[model samples]
Target: MAPPELHPAVLQSVALTVRPTSGAPLALQTKVLDLEPQPDGSTTLVVAPPPGLDPREHHFDATLAWTYPLGRMECTVRTRPGRRAYGDVWLVCANAPATRLQERAYFRARLTVPVLLTWTEATEETEETEETEEQPEPVELHGVVVDLSEGGLLATVPSRPPALGTRVEATVRVDGENLTQPATVVRHVAFASGGHGVAVAFAEPRRHGDRLRAVVFAVERRRRSRT
Candidate 1:
């Protein structure tokens, strides 16, 4: 159902998808029982246990989404044990606008900046007697940074991309200064547009986290000043 201009108080109910901590995906239909907007910018959500659901299994995470006049709003909720009602179900009071993507420990900024990637390849030894692997020369890859966070970055690569679990060193220039760090390829996807999307997580986020956070803050402030 399409609701009017999105607001915390006006949100009555929402479609909820629950994912158990055991990594089992919920395949049943579910909905918020009674959505009550609470004070202090949080909403109280009540959920009833569906068929074959254990009442004691309230410690799980869920994602809820609903459409509004402006657009669709989605948020991740951490379920907790609520009052002993409705067969001892779970309830949550959260801010609807505080989505999972926006609630990161570190802020992220979208950008179209050039990034340099370097990694080494391991070559198998030709001799059957020698079981040791040879270390090949380091190779360089180029990509455009699409999103930047203190912990990781998402880039679009034009050529063959590295496999997941590959570790690489990356460098990005921000505001005339360069930030370099070691990162691992945690995720990768090939788009129909003929480019690959690579997600790299910093091996030591604390190393260059200050610089990354400063850059993000500066970008945010500059944009806010313009608006």
Candidate 2:
């Protein structure tokens, strides 16, 4: 079956692997410029080809992988001779359909990092007047992140986990940088190891998403290199 049409708004980043007929594969990170299929059943993928790509090597087997809201997906396509669409952009035609890969949208890395989680509990207002807004008592919890991802994180806390759907502010140290973001608690589980595991989904900020994905991808690349 043909894959669903990808709206430009949902396209964030793509990982491309190009394999020449007689050379080793080369991996690149790129973004999708367009993906409209022609009447002849061939799909043309307009992408921003990364640096170090040989303009001469156009006919090759390439695999494009990307993540969406539902899950991750990938497809292999045979490239025809590609042409430069504009400055630093290229249009490559694909003669095949995309294969949807059933996996989580974001790549999760098993990382143990210190994180500070804070939330507020609503308290009764001392003043009965409607103009007075009820003050919430702020609560803080210190936890160690068991795993990290672009979407959310799994953290182990010593005390009782926050209730589901609770909004929280988290400050986590990643790659020597402190990232503060708001998240919603999605799950809570009691661990046999004597702590509660809380799963929270991040309210992804555009700028912070890129930085967090960079850290996750860097760690993944390092792990791949060592294997």
Candidate 3:
């Protein structure tokens, strides 16, 4: 699930490894249900086989290559039309899987490559006063990254949730292999994991800012999970 603020594109992909173990009269079809983006920049995708496809009649399957970063994605498929289904998913690189990896066959080692790119673009800044946190830590981890379309990103964590008037530094990671920078923290919200979501605005994004931004995007992408 995603908050209303995060709107992401719907990535489409196919699910291979399905054999006529199914007798489905008609061929199987696949589509991406939706993609959910979180405030942290991570994303989750939902998919399933098309309706009107019979389950017992045919063992149907297909593989899908969705939008960039999420290349070579696969899942076990089943469709009950108006009911629910369970799928086994495996994330692989576009060049991976010389042959479609089978589902449930109890295979050897498998690799799941992430489509998330490590975008760098960050700035450097510091926060002296302890404004926010469930329990303030001595040091804070923060950074900034450019969004997919020149969109900017800000990330920060404070010792505790600060009052609305508090001001702090923001950090941006530089792009092109270099990383790290400085910025300002604007607001803080207490997160469930004893972390605060510190809203920030960078003072200067040029000069290695892009590198940090790219790294943060990579970090954010790694945090995404399919609950």
Candidate 4:
């Protein structure tokens, strides 16, 4: 039986991992270029080939894996066996169902590191008429990172963590280097060990790519050493 057509929005945002049935994997990442819906509920997709990918090998049956709003999806795309276009190549594929999306794509390394968290309360400010009063300092909480990831992290705090969705600044020491960034509390759970588990997502994702990559490399190195 034929599968349902994937949503156009999902097709636009998802990145595809294209693997031909008979060939080596492409080097560069491939993203969706365009999607053309058909009256019969089928859709034609234009996928961008990675740089260094040979244009002559465009024709063949290949498996495409991508993540959409719903979850991860896989489908088979077949290109005509002939000369294909130079820029974006067109392929016909069957729509498939998506599974549950994972919370983290990158490997989460288990480690312990001290961290300082700070945030200000909205109701803490006071009105001053005669003399200008200085704003109260942000409340600081000490915590320890339980696991780390490029996107976010899970930590443990001695006290109850800040309410979910609360934005806070974290100064964490990674490999003797102090890295500070703003993050939002996504999950808070009290553990049996008397500490609270807090999950935070980085607010400014663009600025910490280098630090995250370094941490990932360090974690992988450490894992290799143990193995």
Best by lDDT: 2
Scored against the true structure, residue 209 in model 2 reaches a CA lDDT of: 83
Q: Residue 59 of model 4: what lDDT?
A: 44
Taking the tens digit of each residue's C-alpha lDDT, what string does model 1 give over 1-227? 21111222222345556777667767444455655555553556666555687755654467656532113357666567555544565675443444323655667765667888888754444323353654456789898886687888877787876777888998888777778889888766433233567778888889989888888778778868999
Q: After superposition, how far is residue 219 of candidate 1 from its true place, in Å?
A: 1.6
Question: lDDT score of model 3?
Answer: 0.33
Could you tell me which residue pairs clash in candidate 1?
A: none
Q: After superposition, how far is residue 36 of candidate 2 from its true place, in Å?
A: 54
lDDT of 2: 0.68
Backbone clashes in model 1: 0
Model 2 poorest ten-residue lDDT run: 1-10
Candidate 3 lDDT tens digits, 173-212:
2332332334344434322233334434334556444454
lDDT string for model 4 (81-126, tens) is 2224455464546544333234445545556788888997545244
Better of 1 and 2 by lDDT: 2
Rank candidates by TM-score, best first.
Answer: 1, 2, 4, 3
> Which candidate achieves the best TM-score against the true structure?
1
RMSD of each: 13.2, 14.6, 15.0, 13.7
Model 4 misplaced regions, further than 4 Å: 1-103, 124-133
- Error at 76, model 3, angstroms: 25
Candidate 2 C-alpha lDDT tens digits along 1-227: 22223322223477878886777988888786656567764546667767787644565578777653334557775444345555555556544555545477677665678999999754355334264665556899999886677888878788997788989998889878899999998766443233467778888645478887888788779879999
Candidate 2, which segments miss by more than 4 Å at Cα? 1-102, 123-134, 205-207
